[model samples]
Target: MNEHITEIVIFTALFLLVSGMGFVAARWRRADNLASLNEWGLGGRNFGSWITWFLVGGDLYTAYTFVAVPALLFGAGATGFFAVPYTVITYPLVMLVLIRLWSVSHVHGLVTPADFVRVRFGSPTLALLVAITGIVATMPYIALQLIGIEAVLKTMGVTGDLPLIIAFAILAAYTYQSGLRAPALIAFVKDILIYIVILVAVIYIPARLGGFGSIFDAADAKFAKTPAPGDGTLLNANNQLQYITLALGSAMALFLYPHSVTGVLASRSRDVIKRNMSALPAYSLLLGLIALLGYMAIAAGITPIGTDVNTVVPQLFDQMFPDWFTGVAFAAIGIGALVPAAIMSIAAANLFTRNIYKEYLRRDATDAQEARVSKLTSLVVKVGAVLCILLIDPQFSIDLQLIGGVIILQTLPSVALGLFTRWFHRVGLIAGWTAGMTAGMVLLYNIANPANNHAHFGGSAFPLSKLGFDTPMTVYAGFLALIVNLAVAALATVLARRLGSSEGVDGTSPRDYTADAGDPEVKDDLEVAGST
Candidate 1:
């Protein structure tokens, strides 16, 4: 602790500086009043391309990403590169869909994806399912961010849960006061620091490790010595399937997450979303660099502090850089956590306030009432996230996000697909959600990581051998569950139609999907609906 004084001082100074910025963010955008879901949850829904870029970039490329992706690469070798491909696959695939989401959300004043589900499907029950799934899925995600901070702190010899608690306390305070604006404002600083650290690490650390060629040679030699399956510079047949499915599954689930939807909905218009989708892939380039840090760690021989592989990168920084720059790197990781955690909490809270609280608890809830409830609920969501870190104690931190992807992927048929087609009935959608969620849990339960010495919920890779296949192929549990979800949904829909079941009326029209703010059609559509 005494020896780490310089790192601690630099880390603490930057952390406090961001916290101060968080408190000051309520004034940055200068909203008239944040006592509504539109204002508080969506940052007044008027962010231009640049603000949206930083906010959405900060929201998606999170601290857990900073810590965990590298950790995965360090431990598992080339399979960890899945994160880079998945991120690359996501933006182009989800771009058009997101533009529609942005337009519909803008036209309807929707706050959460579940809110869109309710409008699109006209079923409170389905929306309730979506809301609860989002909140539950997002909780562990928020916990992962806290774990990211914990990883850095532990490397710096700062122990106990006290610092984490205090840090989130500060996060909760400003997020409470300023809502989405707090994260939106702080994201500029967060991304800048992350870029600086990543650029420096990729450049300076590789130089110190002799060069890129030496780093790769060292990593190759190290993996060759151990020579376990899936533990080298190249992929094997067994792990290749897992890598592909994980990448594709994760890509589909990325934009469907509540926080991701929150960021999209915060945009002022469809063109902003379209422009952002084309531009956001730049972060994927950053992610590719971030993953290389793992090999750099292997080359530098930077062992993690304990059994936690997440600490390897931080330890690498401490070993390679001066204490002062290492402190800057730690600050990057810490502040990175705050931005996304705040967004996730706010998103989960908005889901509760709009879909659950308003739909179930208070039908006549005002915009102000909804805003107040969401603010309070965000605090509760953060508390739940804290409890997840303390209690659930996942062996591998990446599981937090994968578990979430599996859970939220259940909503794909209703939330993501329902945006384009209403062919699936609400009942079928409900059945699909139930079946997918159940299968996801059961699959997750059967996964056993012998290395981590955990019996259940070990990871997302479901071995085909478990299904009595002779091969060593494995698939992402979430992707498999999504298949089950879609199959059941389609079969049930056909059955429901044959039985003369009533498909609930969609409150939204096709025009709604194309209506953007300030458009001529948007004004008239809002007038007809009396929502905006």
Candidate 2:
């Protein structure tokens, strides 16, 4: 092993500390028995504002934001910076929708968004679609986290897949033991490390490389030498559509991920959700700062160690910082992967247990049985994610996740908008989801990245002319697919209503959407429903 001893030692020490905390997290907010889905999957639905802030922030920001965003910026220029505005606008969008979701979920004892769909539309079929989409959408995402870990491991001079296997094994063990609580506790350490590392890097790197002006100038000069259209410091007219649509589509998709909603539902109350949404934008500011590392990498004249641009940040730190500090940053990135990976696996497992296993396989499953199944399923999900990275190209996995955004965005019509108005017929929502998902996948498949040998599933950018727009404009496949989805859903709803199709019973009331914690109705309803 050609590992840098100092960096590896520090990284290992910090990682061990977090692993210890992960195991102990099972007892952090001790419950009588974590046999209940509420206790294991949702952290007993009692997280306060501070814990909720870190948990949700840690869950959403992710290793992708840390590694992939900078990597994109390094490789593709301003287009990668789309993450900044997406994250900026995400808070307001979430604040508008998530408070209501929390209220409704709390009142109904809903553990997954699929459960809410099952209750709202009273259609198990529609709920099953939502559940399956979440699991499929989340799998690539979990794989992306492993990519994050792999990047750090590679930067530390650790080769082979053994280290990756060991790290994920530790992550799986803790998540299996503590479920959401493990990530909720580890999120604190992860965020703190990230903040310190990012703050120092932002301040120190720019100063070391002359200034931000030098960094931009270096990036501009580099991109100007390249023939790629959008690979520059500023956006051109042709690429502006892509930037806008990507940012908008991403904002729409952000909260739809099962893990994002899992964080919201785990909050103690609706007020906690509101407070966290407002405060979460601080991380967006951090994200914008982090994206600049791409420019900084260019300024530092750091060549990526391999074809994987995702390693830009790690390689940059390896070159720029002291050995000990590099270790700290690597730990931040590695632990960063763990937090979201744990949450995502737990979230996906919860969906399977509630929506698939219990709803279909065993309707009479007890709370303990549900928890048991969720824990094991979480292990399976993580294993699948690891295999995704081992078997597929890392860049392909990143591209898959970008398309995964499009996949999850299909849920917005059913889940997000469904939170406000039941105007969308359940049948219509199901049709819309199907249309959007299919169109998005087809479009993604047709866009080829020949240079990377990715003939199908190459990238998320599809040309507008393909849709008969008579323009050479390229737009995000997800946004266009969403348009098709909405249009189809509206037309389908009209037809369904005219044909006298049943609109199933609404199990949720308007009051349910505004209920808060400590409300007698909310508490009593959950108590009567038992653990779900």
Candidate 3:
């Protein structure tokens, strides 16, 4: 136990540092009212470029990525590298959609995508469905962050669940006190530590074990001996199509997540968001390095303790590094969990208050009431996420996360495409979301994991055979569902237009898209001006 004291001390200091920042973040900009959704949930919508960059970075790349990506490489051989290409593709995809989302969100004073969906589609039921999906999807994700900290604890042979409860209590307290700013401020430290740790691991680990070539040779030799039929190399003929579809689909769905947009929407200007999207791909380079840790684990001959892929990175660190350095690495992962978990809880809480509670339960809710509801909802979200970790197994929650992606992707037709045009009709968007959601869930439910006794997976891609094809080609369940979503929307739009159905008014303007860093019109205007 003494061997692990260094790691414990370092991580404790880091957690305290984050807590200190959480207490001070409310005063960082000194707003007159921190009791409003805009102030507490959106960080005053005043984050400049540098803070946005760090916040978004830390938000997108969680400890799940830090731990799971490497663990994937260790467990699945070449399949782990899918994260690299997916991260690479994400920025370009967001560039196509996020500018428009920012414009619409800013103009409408929207806190959640579901809020935009309700206004754009003129359907509260559809919006509520989207809201529920966002909450369900986000809950497990918050819990998954705890897995990073748990990995560190397990590595130090710290048994029992008491430590996890303590860590989450700290996270919940600060998140309640500081709101989005807590996470944004904490992100600076988390990203800095992650960059340092990954750089050191990529450099020092290979040097100690051998060069990159030697490490790969060792990994290759180990895998060659085992020779699993579907493993080795980054691609295989059997699963090539599945890989591409999953990667591309994930890239498109990445920013569709409410938490993801929550970070971007908090920015001070369109330029801040655009510039961040352009520069954010640089983090992909780091992600590639992190994923290679899986290969490093193979070379180190370290088998993960259980079926929990998230634990792989920490386990590797414990085996490879000295107790002190392991502590630093553990601190990095533990801090990594806190930043995103804070933001996710806030985002989920905002969705509940703005789209659910305020919309249906209290239409006349004031800004202070909205803030109070959201604050309480955020606490509920954290508690729910904790329950997810305690009750549901990690593997199950991970599967549910894929389901979350599919569910969020259904919002794209309403949120992303709705930004550019409204010809699709409000009712059409609703129909598309419903059909797409149903198809995606059904397909995912039918996909079986052979290794796990052919049990259906929440993360599994739909086989082409189910769609009336007999080829080896496969597609992501979300992408396929999106295709159905678009088709349904297009068809419904034509029908709605032919029947002279109400198309509803968009509350944003063309000029809104062009508004940038220093525009005065970007501020709140009472009269709504827009175009078709």
User: Against the unseen true structure, what C-alpha lDDT does each candidate score?
Assistant: 0.87, 0.89, 0.80
RMSD of 3: 2.8
Model 2 TM-score (2 dp): 0.97
Instruction: Please give the range of 10 consecutive residues that has the lowest summed lDDT in model 2.
Output: 523-532
Error of 3 at 492 (Å): 2.2
TM-score against native, each model: 0.97, 0.97, 0.95
- The count of backbone overlaps in candidate 1 is 0
Please provide, for model 3 over 217-250, each residue's C-alpha lDDT reduced to its tens digit, 9 standing for 90 to 100.
8877776777466567556776777688778878
- Alpha-carbon shift of residue 399 in model 3 (angstroms): 1.3
Q: What tens-digit string does per-residue lDDT give for candidate 1 at 1-532?
A: 3888999999999999999998898888776677777778888777899999999999999998998899888888898999988998898877867778877776676778888899898899999999999987888888899989999999899998899899999999999999999999999999999999999888898888899998889888888887467688788889889999999989988888999999988887778888988899889999999999999999988898868898998989989899999999999999999999999999999989988999999999877888899999999988888877877765543566667889898999998898899999998999988899889988998998887776988888899999899989889999889989999999998999899998877888888888877786554322322352
After superposing candidate 1, which stretches have Cα over 4 Å from the reference?
Answer: 392-400, 523-532
Q: Write the per-residue lDDT of candidate 2 for residues 270-372, one digit (tens) a residue.
A: 7888887789999999999999998899888878776877788998999999999999999999999999999999999999999999999999999889999
Best by lDDT: 2
Error of 3 at 229 (Å): 2.9
